[model samples]
Target: MKLLLSFFLIFPLLLSSQSFEKGEKLFVEGKFNQAQLVLENYLKSNPNHLKTLEYLGDIAGQNKAWDKSISYYKKLENLKPTEANYYFKYGGALAMKSLEVNKIKALGMIGEVRSSFEKAIALNPKHIEARWALIELNLQLPAIVGGSESKAIKYSSELRELSPVDGYLSRGHIEEHFNRNTEAEVQYKRAILIGGSKVCYQTLADFYKNKMKQPDKANKVWEEYKNKNNKGIK
Candidate 1:
């Protein structure tokens, strides 16, 4: 009787999570419009559901509805202020919005994006993606706008301590940004040899195409990626 009663008590929660699961699956499959519809409808009833808000935020970001993405993520931040990923998403959306506007408008956002990314790192010292964002921002912006290769390398070191894949990937990007193609290729290839992430492979592939002028190498990487992910073959 106790077991049966416990099952009944947990069933509703399971059903709720299943809906969230479906929404997440749709989001992952790039059905952002459908995911937005489902998640938005779900939020109509569960107005403060964090995971649903996350999905809505992701869908909005994917669609380039930057303001809406910021809105959803802000609501989530209000609900749980310390989640590193929330701040990362908020900062990323803010950066995109900044890019869409004029320099004057973007100027105000640059500091905001930097601060939010920093806050994410403060909240989770090992948040690799947040660290990567900071590194990129620091490297991309000019000296007058607070660009600092020194700061970026600091973050890169911290990321390397946390994740080898992202560490080398970040290093490759940094090298590429400064036109250090030889070093960039070496770092990208190193990241690829680690081999858990598709992004690393694509980064190496893009380097071959864009920097080395090697489409054949790029195609080979793409084929390798497809082969690893495809399941229809023997």
Candidate 2:
């Protein structure tokens, strides 16, 4: 009788652990629907499971179910506000939802994204991806709705300082859009010097030819790019 009681006592724990494990594995395998079902079922009983909430948020974000993702992430934030990743992802989902639906909605999402990113930054100032995303988001907004060329330049410069190779190309876009032609040229050239890309070369060529009215220079750059990439066959 005692042994049977002991087994009964331990069985629920074992079952709960197994459910979490299986749900986690399904999540890792990208079986989000299965994972979500398992996780949701688990949460019905174990409502305070932090990891389950995190995984659900991840699944929802991956599926682009922004509202669901935000709900799960909010639960996570309430549980552990210090964890920067949750905030970053929650903000990202909101930003994506804005883009997927309406700009007005997207504008609201941008505020959430900024707040989350800022919180993440405060928690870990060296968070490179968060910084990059912030810069990208700032650049994407219009001036009338809190977008500022100065802010873009500032964040872009900060990003460049962190990793010049990754940030130069992005900085070039900010410069280009702000009509800072000379700065843009310097940035594009820096990107090329630090192992840029064919696309970068093409962009620079177009800029020189059309915007700067320097066809000869553009042709020279294009010829160099074509020779390097369009080799052997065509």
Could you say which candidate leads in TM-score? 1
lDDT of 2 by residue, 56-146 (tens): 9888888889899989888888889998887888878777777787666666667778899888878877667777777777777777877
**Native RMSD of candidate 2 (Å):** 5.6
Clash pairs, model 1 backbone: none
**Candidate 2 displacement at residue 110 in angstroms:** 3.4
Estimate every model's Cα lDDT from 0 to 1: 0.87, 0.82
The worst-scoring run of ten residues by lDDT in candidate 2 lies at 225-234
Task: Kindly list the per-residue Cα lDDT of model 1 for residues 1-234, writing each as its tens digit.
Answer: 999999999997787777778888898898888778878877877899998999898888888999999999989889999898999999999999999999999998899899999999899887888888989899889989899988998888787788887888888888888899989988888887785467888888988998889999999988887887785431
Error of 1 at 66 (Å): 0.5
Question: Distance from true position, residue 128, model 2, in Å?
Answer: 1.6
The C-alpha local distance difference test score for the whole of candidate 1 amounts to: 0.87
Error of 2 at 102 (Å): 4.4
